[model samples]
Target: TITEICDRYPARIVDVGPKVAIIEMVGTESVLEEFIEEVRPTGIVEMIRTGVVSMGRGTRIHDTNFINRRALADAAAKADSGNGRIV
Candidate 1:
């Protein structure tokens, strides 16, 4: 049960779509097994399983667009550091 899994573990809710959410877990591997057990009988139309290859912690910037634009600008500024680029 996705709801039960959400209730049992610490997770982050990703906006996958209007009807679906990607529940990212931050707990032991055992919790994932439990989640599978709960969801199997729900008759939901779609479900996916994946393993986390790597993980990182900490906060993300609140203003994502602004941060992205700044990052792109910084990258552009450095692109011509050695052999100057035109326009």
Candidate 2:
């Protein structure tokens, strides 16, 4: 039922628990509003429970080691010179 709801709506399944689901709909906020209104009674937990800790928009986790090394080097330089803070 949860999968069906997500597929039918323009929503993303953010998280799923044994008895709950957290979701987000990109556009058409009205659709998501209606979904929440109807599904809230189903005992599903919302992401708001955790205060919605989300990565900033367009953020991506890079698995490349070289990129990570560069980032660390830049961070060290900035910290040593008090030029900037590590992100």
Candidate 3:
């Protein structure tokens, strides 16, 4: 279902782990916000707005390490118990 939802937008799922995923979507801030809202209800325990790449120059303009380790751990636990879905 997550894959289906992402396919509706200009998004690429870059990577996926047991409890986390890296998704790259090309859009404006508003579009990003809308995407977040769209995916929030799909059992996504945590999401980190990792960075943005400039479309014109293909350069990263912003980056951050804003990950929530506790949430990720919790999500992992839930997935291990079949109570969560990795997004």
Candidate 4:
């Protein structure tokens, strides 16, 4: 059923586990709502929605400071989340 929804809409099943499936989707608000309706019966325990973050029309998105990852190793991820690698 999820595969059918993905085929019919602009969405991707990013990850699935024993108890959860993460679907990343992009569409107009109404379209997303429709997709949710299609999948709602599967029981949605959690959901995360992405929102637009705009710096402005012509502004360039800034990149973080250059860090030589080889020098930092595991410390980089640990610093980022206060835990090990996220996934």
Best lDDT goes to which candidate? 4
Give Cα distance to truth, residue 62, candidate 4, Å: 3.6
Candidate 4 Cα RMSD (Å): 14.6
Give one digit per residue, the lDDT tens place, for model 3 in 15-68.
888777778787778888888889887676756675675553323323322246
lDDT of 4 by residue, 38-87 (tens): 98998888888786544533323232333345437657766778655643
What is the TM-score of each predicted model, taking all chains together? Answer: 0.38, 0.42, 0.47, 0.57
Q: What TM-score does structure 1 among the candidates reach?
A: 0.38
The reply for model 2, stretches above 4 Å from the true place, is 47-87
Worst 10 residues of 3 by lDDT: 57-66
Tell me which of candidates 3 and 4 scores higher on lDDT: 4
In model 4, pairs of residues that clash are none
Worst 10-residue lDDT window, candidate 2: 44-53
lDDT (tens digit, per residue) of candidate 2 on 3-61: 77778777878877776666776645576577777666666543442333457443344
Better of 1 and 2 by lDDT: 2
Please count the clashing residue pairs in each candidate, in the order shown. Answer: 2, 0, 0, 0
Q: Considering only N, C-alpha and C atoms within 3 Å, which residue pairs clash in candidate 1?
A: 1-38, 1-39
> After superposing candidate 4, which stretches have Cα over 4 Å from the reference?
55-87
lDDT of 2: 0.66
Writing each residue's lDDT as its tens digit, candidate 1 over 1-87 gives: 466557766755565566666666655679767765665575446566565677545555555687789877877887777466634
